[model samples]
Target: MRKALTLIGTGLAAALALTACGGSDSTPSADATLDPANPTTITVGATPVPQGRILEFVDENLAKDAGIDLDIKEFTDYQTPNIALSDGSLDANYFQHLAFFDQQVADKGYDFEHGEGIHIEPYAGFSSKHQSVDDIPEGATVAVTNDPGNQPRALKMLEAEGLLAGIEDDSAALTLTDEQNPKGLKFEENQPEILVQLIDDPKVDLAIINGNFILDAGLNTDDAVIVESAENNPYANFLAWKAGDDNPAIAKLEELLHSPDVKKFIEETWPNGDVFPAF
Candidate 1:
């Protein structure tokens, strides 16, 4: 059984920072001293769907008693969260999976550290016109995300469905070569959020959408023509913070996130397996 927590109103002031990541006007400074006995607020940025929703759950049910307060902020794009975290506009963030995080660290040189997987939102190919993968005709138009981290996953899924080949690795530059695209399928690359809109476009036959956008669009995984398997899925989203910033409140929040209560909440909330607990 999960223990219920008592809410505490600290009234401890949060400091102001310039809007670096399109988030709050004021964020708790990373340099402020945090007392373990009193509740501390940590501003975090996340995508609105499962990531923000999960943090909301922690804030509502778990944070108070554990001496932490989560000031959750929602972001639609993937880049801003890390940008905010690096710029000190946010204390931490919870959105990207390991692959995306690694790529961002490599490209942007963000000194970030992440926790174990909290949950996996499996990548799925959704189509409005085609009922199934078999129904996709020759010379079809497929819409996929243009981001380096996820484009490869979309390509790999296409390869798995026998639609494309010669995907040597998870590379963003990967494209359908002469022999790879046997059916002569056309590819339209766009941002992950934009791919959701392309699903209903008359010109697009299929759109491989990111999991969060799929949920934000209120579409079910059951509607996907081709869905990535959750088993051994490497794309589990987790909490992240800047390296060498050992804020105890951040540690408390991370622990509460992996607690059994969170696991149960995920199971009950997304019962259809739209979201799977990685722990």
Candidate 2:
């Protein structure tokens, strides 16, 4: 992971219709195909930040040494990578965490599996009205990401802050809770991309946003009331591929991605800790 994230608001999106195939090689036998015996390129779909930048680094610095060529296809949204991968448009993808992977499979029944855990994009609760969780008042209007993969995380943060308790299920929505909700908080759920809008909404007391949104909106990490901790975090992003992962090129790519050099790069590149190594 290299760049923090700039494409979220730039109104530029990579065309998902394009094939996952990529750049040519000097060697006549080499191409952007799954030729395990030859130096072949493996195409991967990713979001521009961190994932796309990471791929770029690997392509320039590591993949050639490993006898694997890297083809990076950038996508703007979370769903398109998996969709392109499943349809054979992409050889692999690296953008989402295991929770999102599970949610995608459970919801859409996609035949996919994540290969290696790479990095963590810390989720955070940002608020314009409240400085701390204790500053929140009763009957407050809170907003959360409505995406299936990230909604529960926002509610779990609220649950930890004493607005509610007894969150037995990660998939369960806050509206379905039967436990005591002491704060009587009102929740507003919206698409993750638009969550930054709620920060200025007069009615919103707390707005929980994911890392990508935080980076896009240029919010201060120090301002978050609560941030997702690194210890045993379940939300580490990984490289995902379709079922029956027997590609030799993919194995090489995984090795390069999880290498010590990448770890050092993440720590040094994002010293303020926008992203951290998960492996």
Candidate lDDT (C-alpha), each:
0.79, 0.72
- What's the CA error at residue 229 for candidate 2, in Å? 1.7
> Pairs clashing in candidate 1?
none
Worst 10 residues of 2 by lDDT: 21-30
Q: What is the lDDT of residue 189 in candidate 2?
A: 80
lDDT of 1 at 173: 31
lDDT string, candidate 1, 124-182, tens digits? 99888989888999899999888887788888788889988777556443355768788
- Backbone collisions counted per model: 0, 1
Minimal lDDT window, size 10, model 1? 1-10
- How high is the lDDT of residue 129 in model 1? 95
Q: What is the lDDT of residue 90 in candidate 2?
A: 84
Q: Who wins the TM-score comparison?
A: 1
Per-residue lDDT for 157-272 in model 2, tens only?
A: 66766777765446445464445466677778877777878887888988888786676567756789878777787788888777665677877787778899898888887677
Q: What's the residue-level lDDT of 185 in candidate 1?
A: 85
